[model samples]
Target chain A: MEKKLKIVGFLCNWCSYAGADLAGVSRFQYPADIRVIRVPCSGRVNPLFILKCFQEGADGVLVSGCHPGDCHYQEGNYYTRRRMMMLKDLFCFFGIDKRRFHISWVSASEGKKWADVVTAVVEDVGAALRGSEKQ
Target chain B: MASTENRSEKNTRRESIEQFLYRLLKEGKVDAVLVPKRHPGGNIVSPVLISEPSQIKGTDPLAPVQTVNAASIVKELVKEPVDKKIAAVLRPCEVRATIELIKLKQLSDESLLIIGYDCPGVYNVKEYMHGIENREDKEAFTEEHIHDFLSGDGDLVRESCRFCTYFTADSADVDIAWIGVEPPGIIVAARSEKGRRMTGGMNTGDKDAPTVRKETIGKIEARREKRQKSGIDNLLDLIQPCIRCYNCREVCPLCYCKECLLEPEKMGYTSERYLSRAERKKQIRMPVDTLLYHLTRINHMGYSCVSCGICEQACPMDIPLGTILHVFSKKIQSLFDYVPGRSRDDELPLTTFREEELSEVEDV
Candidate 1:
């Protein structure tokens, strides 16, 4: 039997976490595979944290933060944006599928958008797993 | 390229630079001079810290051999404040690394004088040692290497050196400008107040930077810029030969962790954990996590990597770690428009960010 895909979501407390709560309250449907880990800010999310998740058998990882100019700490999301962009390239350079790592911006009011982003990420990760199986 | 007539003229100027160091010692401008000197046995050269003018006799700052990045040595020498100043003659990379170390609080730059010079490049240590062992006049050999480099011959140069664009020590307190200058002569320019004070009354005939020097440096940089575009497309395949020798970590000037997490004590697993890990990975390769180690290093130090190429030299596997790091760091640095070792005033990218910058990386 194929392993059930496990996704880890790193949601910022000020926005993304609240956005996730809104999604749940509104009964918006997204994959149940994602296990949420609330961090103080997206800037607190080290590249090692994501890599450790992969090492510990996470099939996919989603990092969602406050929108670009809306970071609660002013520029925390900007740092995350730069760091994650480089990390994504680093993963590809190491032969890891880019689909396995995703970054998005979701605010407390954007519950519907959050659900859609999760659905898109899970589908991409599923496709990646199938492609690796073929290989 | 220096003409034959220019070479002879520059030889005299080279001697004057050496004499200038001797005068610095006599004048007490510095407590000591740190520069590479030929070993008494001949054919071998290493950095020697000399306090006396006599000991400065064979000081050759232009030797195309780098035993280690001199900045680390500078770090060791001046980790604490000193009563007297020390003049360190360094290559551009060494000077740059020193600046970074200062920012990291690893080195106190107060009582140090950095005299940086134009570097043509260096050969791989093993290759340099082999090439010089049979030669009677090692100085002549080094001279020939520099001559060949200036004349468009780099067959003996290391791959990393060939790809380097920052050959001149623009960030150093005092700079020796050789580009676009006629042979046997170098123009020394002071970039700081301390530099101006030290070189003052030394009679080392200073001049304004030549107009042609910028264009010469620009041309070399443009050539290297083309090669910088080639990144390691298959990093995993390239690192497959890693035997877990920790040599790269040992020699990296920027890898300054007192307790490295990659050490055997930290990374080594118990018998049960090893067996379980192997089971999980489905017959994992022995000495597992080699790829993981490399990736972790890239993530940790990729931002500050100055492309000194010393780490690549330290690798037993000849893994081209330097070029790989340079490629990765170039990408990361560009994301924030951050250039490591550019200046002490420039904040580290990872430690600081602008509110308006890097918005393109934000997901919609």
Candidate 2:
């Protein structure tokens, strides 16, 4: 059997965590690769956490928060958007495969959308890992 | 006007600067002036805060040695409210770093006057200490350095300084310029209203900044840019020898965090956790998280980095951290169309965001 790829997911408590919970309750099946960690808001996710995940042997990382204006704390995800954007650029500059890192806006009501997002992210991460292994 | 023969005998430029600093003290223009002076028994030149006019005798404002960034000292000097005004003599990079600190709220500029100068770069600290070990006339050594630098031979300077484009103090309040002037002539150019007021009675030379100065700076800028492009490749390989001494962070002027997250205790690594990590990875680097430290530092302060190259100087492993950080930060700053220390009014890139900008960062 092949070893499982470890993907760390940071989900904002207000929107993304609720969305993931809704996906489970509604039986919307998605990849089981991600290990979810709840955060107060996307803004609370320091870029250090993402880098730390990579340092600790995580194969991929995902950060999900509420839509820009729909942030529970009001303007939390906006800061996350900017921070993550810079982090993404930094990752690329350091020769990290950008596809292994994903950012999304998931709403509490969007259970099906969350499931689809996870499936796509898992596929991308798997492909990226395989591509790097070949090289 | 003295003859060329007389100029050759006396170090006129150093003497004139010493005279200017003495006047600043005697005339009470500033309560004290912060300038570099040679330590009593060594070739080491460090920043000294001199209040007495007589103490300005051995101070060399144009010394080809940078012991510390000096912005960190400036930060410490004015961290709280002070009653006295101080004039800080600094190089172009030091002034830029000071401006960034002012924006970051780490340093207050209320009681500080930044006097910057045209810098013909300094040698690396180790190289400088070694080069001047047996020299008796330290002043002659500096004069020879300036002569070589003026003649466009930058081979003896630090690697970072050789490729540094900001060799003049354009961002400073008062700029003491000598790069393009005839020998022994220095021009004091006041850049701001505060500068103008502070230098009110001082007689700047009758001559305007020569056109040749601009041309010289342009040529240097072009050459350095080309050098910068070719020198910044293979960053990972360059940092391979880093011993995780944290010297780079200790000496960085911009790293003002009270408690750093990179500390060993903060990392929370137990012996069991280390074994587990090793087991999981099949093998692990002994002093782990070195790459993480560098990357995290880049992410945190890359936007505010002034490319002073002090970090490279402080590294025990001789990592070309200065070039790596400089090149990386240049790219990161360009993303937001921002330049650190360019202006006091501009908001830090990480602190502010546009509601309508960076739409591509989000997927789905």
Candidate 3:
């Protein structure tokens, strides 16, 4: 049996966070593995913050901001994308599996897409947990 | 053994020192000489800028073990208007660090005529002092031990000097490069117009001997071999004796921080917790940051470690800080064709953003 993996997700309030809230109102079911922290803009995440979370033992991390040009702050998601891209590259250099982290462009209106992304990421993290245990 | 290269230019350091001072004083180029002068006390020497040549003739090239990084000094000087060019005899690392400081806008090239040396390596103040303190005549003990202390076959060099590969001066406006070829002097490879112009009328000739450079490299490698396993053991060992003291920063020539991120009064510093319950009270200041202290300084100036080996020399506990610095500098600079301090203008990889760099990227 795979142990429950604790996943932390940084969801931008205008997009992913609102979409997550909509999933609840729409009665959609997703895995409870993720604990979401809402931020005004995804660009607030620094690589140091991510490294700190990993160092303090988070099994998986998901960062969902608005779609590329659809940031509530107009350019916030674009900046977040570049920073997270660099952060993931750093993690890969340390031999962390790509499957353990997720970044997506979910919009405020895309509640169904948010539910689908959560289901997929949670299952992927669950599978990774199993694989790491065997090794 | 005194490097055989020391003999050829028999009066090279002396001549170069005289020419630089003459240019600075007679031509009004610089205000002073920021080097160590010896006192009768034997162990105590301080960083002073000599305006008069008579004052600098007493410069203890082997004693005082300079801890003030000439790199940071150049940076400080750059802040003011250049009333005159200040010719500084900096270690290769300090020269490179000065170039970097200039590049970083901390220093200006106009105010400095960097006189760099082919460093044979210097001793930690404490260790050299101990050797002196244990002997009958402190000055004689230091003079006698300079060879044994720096020689690889003799007592181990300060760990910083052992791992450093750039003992020769490769970059500087004006260099008395330790060609490490024959003895008593360097072959003087003029890499810059400033160096070439300075030695224009001299009998300085080309080094047709490739074997000499290779031989010097062979000596350096022999020392580097003994320096292995020192990197890991040294960094881990720094946890003790570090005491979170910022003395290394104060002594370091490159560690110029008007407002450092590590200062507790800066408002962002978080209090650290210690693992040992018995040692908890002793850990309040948190050994400040063994990793960040190394990492941030490297980030800020990795491209400039001239391998001066001063950071380790200043460590109170004798931590081999310079070895760890060189390790990271070596790994980081391999990506850029640019070796730190080798050039005054190479842009740092981290500081510059490239539109087409295609640097390491993770696959989706």
Assess every candidate by TM-score: 0.91, 0.93, 0.70
For model 2 the local lDDT of residue B65 reads 86
- The residue-by-residue lDDT of candidate 2 on B1-364, one tens digit each, is 1233344576667777788889888999899999999889869898999999899999986778898999989999999879898999998888988999998999778888999888878888888898788988777677777776766645768877888888888788888888778767788878777888887878585323588887877887887777774325466677789888889998898999999999978765899999998999999876887888898889878899988889988998988888889878887888899878777778898888887888788764
lDDT of 1 by residue, B247-348 (tens): 888777777778888887777889999899888877877677787888888887787788889888888888988888888888777776877788889998
lDDT of 1 by residue, A1-114 (tens): 445679999999999999999999999998877899999999999887898888878999999999988999988888888788889877767667988889999999989998
Extract clashing residue pairs from model 2.
none
Worst 10 residues of 1 chain A by lDDT: A89-98
True-vs-predicted CA distance for residue B135, candidate 1, Å: 1.4
Model 2: interface root-mean-square deviation in Å = 2.2
lDDT of 2 at B356: 84
Q: Where does model 3 sit among the CAPRI classes?
A: incorrect
What is the fnat value (0 to 1) for candidate 3?
0.02
Looking at model 3, residue B105 earns an lDDT score of 71
| Fraction of true interface contacts that also occur in model 1 | 0.56
Q: lDDT for every model? A: 0.81, 0.85, 0.62
Clashing pairs for predicted structure model 1, backbone only? B10-B183, B10-B184, B10-B185, B11-B184
Tell me what fraction of the real C-alpha contacts between chains A and B each candidate also makes.
Answer: 0.56, 0.55, 0.02
Better of 1 and 2 by DockQ: 1
Ten consecutive residues with minimal summed lDDT in candidate 3 chain B? B355-364
